[model samples]
Target: MTRKVDYLFLRKGSQNWHLKLQYPGDLGQKIGRKRIEKSLGTPDRAQAEILALPYIQEHKMHLLHGHKDFRIVWKHRFEPGRQHVGPAGERIIATDRELIYLDPQGVITKRAPNGDHFIPVPPLLEQKAAVRREQLRRRGVRNSDDSIIDTYLKHANVTGYNEREARAVWSLYKELTNGKPLREATREDGRKIVQYFEDNGLKSATIQKKVGWLNAAINLAIGETKLSFNPFSAIVPKRTDSERRLPLSEADMKLVRAGMEQLDRRDQLLLRFLATTGARLSEAFEIESELMERGCRYVIIGRKTPQSHRRVPLPAAVLPFLPRQIDGQQFQGTARSASKRLNRFLDDIGITDPRKVIHSLRHRAQDRLRAAGCPIDYRWALLGHEEKTVAEGYGLGFPVPALKRWIDKIGF
Candidate 1:
């Protein structure tokens, strides 16, 4: 068990919540107090819970990052919507119902005295919200869980995580928080979260991922609400040794192709595409069919990294059958859903190595590209990987025809 920081506490004398903060190092008292105590002001546990979150977050920021201003954290806890600096200098947005944040004249808007926007509240939107609220009520999803989950979900698209997956992480936190707001999440609450994972016999890596997701949510919430303290950051998850995912060999590739001979067309196409292009399953789905059909010149593989996602040349054989464009994402279901079936096929093919899943096909593609005399420069381009060194950064990578030749050699 790790030694804890008790940042938020319920006073035994007053029964009201109080903030107790101390920076880790014995640094300047000017940055923050040596020991600070402030009344959180509500006898009600629920209200106290909401009030404590940002102060706790602020204290942690001060302790770890030398954040000097505690007043900002104080405001965030009590007021979600307040005047603050914007790109255009000063701007104010209400707690909710804020988007298209400027009028034609480009002036900021203010919320009600309670920090909530009341006007322009559409009845249809209200009705939908009421229905959802009732649904949550019936389902027993606590109030404290909803906004925290929403915060994470809203940021998921920007952060490149599935909203459903991020919600699942906070759902666990919400269960732990009950109906209390995420603001009230104390050091003990964090300990309980870690304990829940450990008690359930989860692996350290799994627990770390879960906790990491929560920390991200907290950070996003803090950034928007202007709170700095994050108890989740304080909880260091234990690291575990993990298996290395080595690529499949040429012989192994032959076995995989042979195994795929019996798979469904969708699965077959998906695997073959991954193997040939050396694209991630994600980018494999998003290949621009129009670019692919244009003389098989280049297929757009949407990668997170800009340079890696450049137009990759398509193998000739796939051009005839490939669609011109996928509407949005390439796959309908999640990668996990596809992987469950893909993994089964991988196992059937005698590639029982856990690390060698559909992803390893790309590695095999790299291997085949190398075996076919493709230069390292062309290989990295096809694989959607960044150049390893500054020396390799001389020019734009190999042309389409050169990349095509190497990828062509490995075609099914």
Candidate 2:
């Protein structure tokens, strides 16, 4: 027959008590006693009763045989190879029906009953998962410089530059490609490219124009491509204000005029027309006979713009160099070859300043106009620039006389 057992508790000290599972031992010894106490310093019998139930349940088999107590059996359940040791020698335990073992150093190492080592769950897994999800959301995004530049080229064409100018702009874009992604291109790369042009003897204006093209490429990348920012936006080109003007002095003018006398009559008139009219070399080269009205003292020709197509007055100094009848024909030779011949004339005259070339005549005209007190408005009109206010809106058309007056004041 199976023997029934019950737990007995006795107050030992202030709050501690000895709890024994009562059962018959082999002839005499009663079941072993285990300590039961509350951490609170109170002799509360209710606390012992609550703890005694589980203790008895766990050691019920051993308790009935009178071979062990609740604590001893419980401790044995936690030890890897010793499920029969008494509580004092069992350095392991079980709770929540799961085994928990402590190393000799008293550090609790596990909570599983299978004796498997435990690891604290990492707290950052959720955060890492969120980041991974975001990365996936942005994958397959396009960000190539070529794609950006192609979009810009399409828009630039609609905005009015010819194929040649557009091609020049693209050449600048190619030079800026360091084979890195747009996001990785930095301001330092822009600075280095700017410095390279400067070191290679390029003029500041040329460098600025080249840099402007590069900046346009970067802007296109930002506005039309996937790039969110332009690395070259903040980079400023170095300025060399000293090269702004290269006007001919009176002595230099005399030498240049004398050299003109050595050329053919038509060529002499061409040089005189350029000096007196302050026309660009290309504009002057493209002039037609029909554009010139006899006795009108002004020539009207098509230029880069309608505003640029204005009457350019003939100065008295230009009369001696004019032909009896103007002929409408293209220059027989290239502008470059003609420029070389003109430079040779300057060399012969001993004007050593390289900047004192044919373009100097235009600068001299501006200088002369300023010296004669031509108003800024009149000068701008003579130069065929769009009026300041009009440029802000449309553009103003200055009367031919107003432009002619400014040119007349710049007498040879």
Candidate 3:
């Protein structure tokens, strides 16, 4: 039996489930897609749901870390004077002077001057072959010549999302160490990297994150590559008391409300959603459309972190301007673009304080809750904060009506 999935829609005359994802606002123009649709190739509801998971995850990943083109790197090998088989099982009768070719669709063929058909290698084939050659070259490298950063990165067990962050750390480490091999890197090399960040005036948090990523990579290499001590181990950054940014103030909120008229409809809705619901910018933008279908009643916020995932009731004052779900997403554009536009609007509206930014609206919501005398437990649950004690984690935090009661207390 088939059940309905939010993004999986069945055409009127078709049984196969199809995924239709629409990018929000300017995101469509940037990603080169107003919407992307793909067939799930399943009539059974359960199988369709299962097949949709990867597509949904990929879409969400793109939302978090801008869009990237999708391509599958095909690996093909051809030897001269020997019969070779292609991915699709097409037999290529090789000649001694044969030249291998590949097409855009990843099909491999051979060309021979001895009256054999001339198969043109697609440009994509050359790109894939170059990558294959690099892999082969890396495999041939001895431990003495192998780069610590490169080796650890190649073998690092990171997800597609985190891979980008890991590589970014590798880029910095490679530059700092001048591409030094694992065997050659000293603890001083690690110190040099930290000192470079400090010299460049990077924030303590940013420095810690980059160093931590490199440290973890080296640690992984130690276990798998049988290296000695991690050069980055035991090199922790000292904690610093950073100036806390003021949450959205009463005057800041007024200025934003006044400036709301200048923003686009979508931006306006996003601001109101954040101000009313107190959702993180990412949480509000990437929230699932299926989670927004309570008929303007409430919206559920879910993120990678369990503590940040919770159900937030929609305030009635802001209901008239609530955003409509497009495709499977509640809002359009992206969190990044939305933040930029909102901050710019804030600057224009005379809210020039760096301590008060777009996120201050979320702070205003907390203030409203606190001023209304909402309980601490309710505040924590509504804001998706982690449980403070064992008792708070015992059951479902609160009923929707109970959550709604506190939400109603938040006057827009």
Candidate 2 residue 363 C-alpha distance from true site, Å = 2.4
Q: lDDT of model 1 at residue 39?
A: 92
Q: Write the per-residue lDDT of candidate 2 for residues 1-412, one digit (tens) a residue.
A: 6233235444455455445644444423443544323233235556655656765664554443342211232233353544323355545554535666676686776555533322233358765775655544444233455566566667665333333344444443345553456677777766766667777887777666656655776677666556776766656555654465488789987887677667766556667776777776656666555333334455665355655665566666775655555576535464556677666777878777877887787788778888989887677666666533455235435555456656777666
Worst 10 residues of 1 by lDDT: 69-78
Model 3, span 1-412: residue lDDT tens: 5444578788888889888887787767777777779888988767877888877765665564442322322223355567666567656655554545555465765453423223334489776876666544444434443355566667754544455566655655555666677567788878887788788877767677778777876777777756777877766577683446678777777777777789888788788878777778888866564343324356667564667677777777667775453346656776777889888999999988888888887777788999999998899878877543656557667777788788777655
Ranking by lDDT: 3, 1, 2
Candidate 3 regions with alpha-carbon error over 4 angstroms = 1-163, 220-228, 234-236, 292-296, 323-327, 386-393
Residues 1-412 of candidate 1 have per-residue lDDT tens digits of 6333366576777877687766554554557457668898877656766787877765655554442211122223123455444467544443533422444366645433323311233478766876666544454564644665566656665344455555555666666756446666676777677888889877667677777777887788788884566768868555665555778876777888678777887777777677777778777656535343324467666555565656577676565555665445445465666778887888998988878887887777777777888777677767766644654445656666766777787665
Model 2 backbone overlap count: 0
TM-score of each: 0.55, 0.50, 0.56
Give the Å shift of residue 211 in candidate 1. Answer: 3.5
Q: After superposition, which runs of candidate 2 have C-alpha atoms over 4 Å from their true positions?
A: 1-154, 157-184, 261-269, 285-311, 314-341, 385-387, 390-398
Where's the lowest-lDDT run of ten residues in candidate 3?
67-76
Give the TM-score (vs. native) of candidate 2: 0.50
**Candidate with the greatest lDDT versus the true structure:** 3
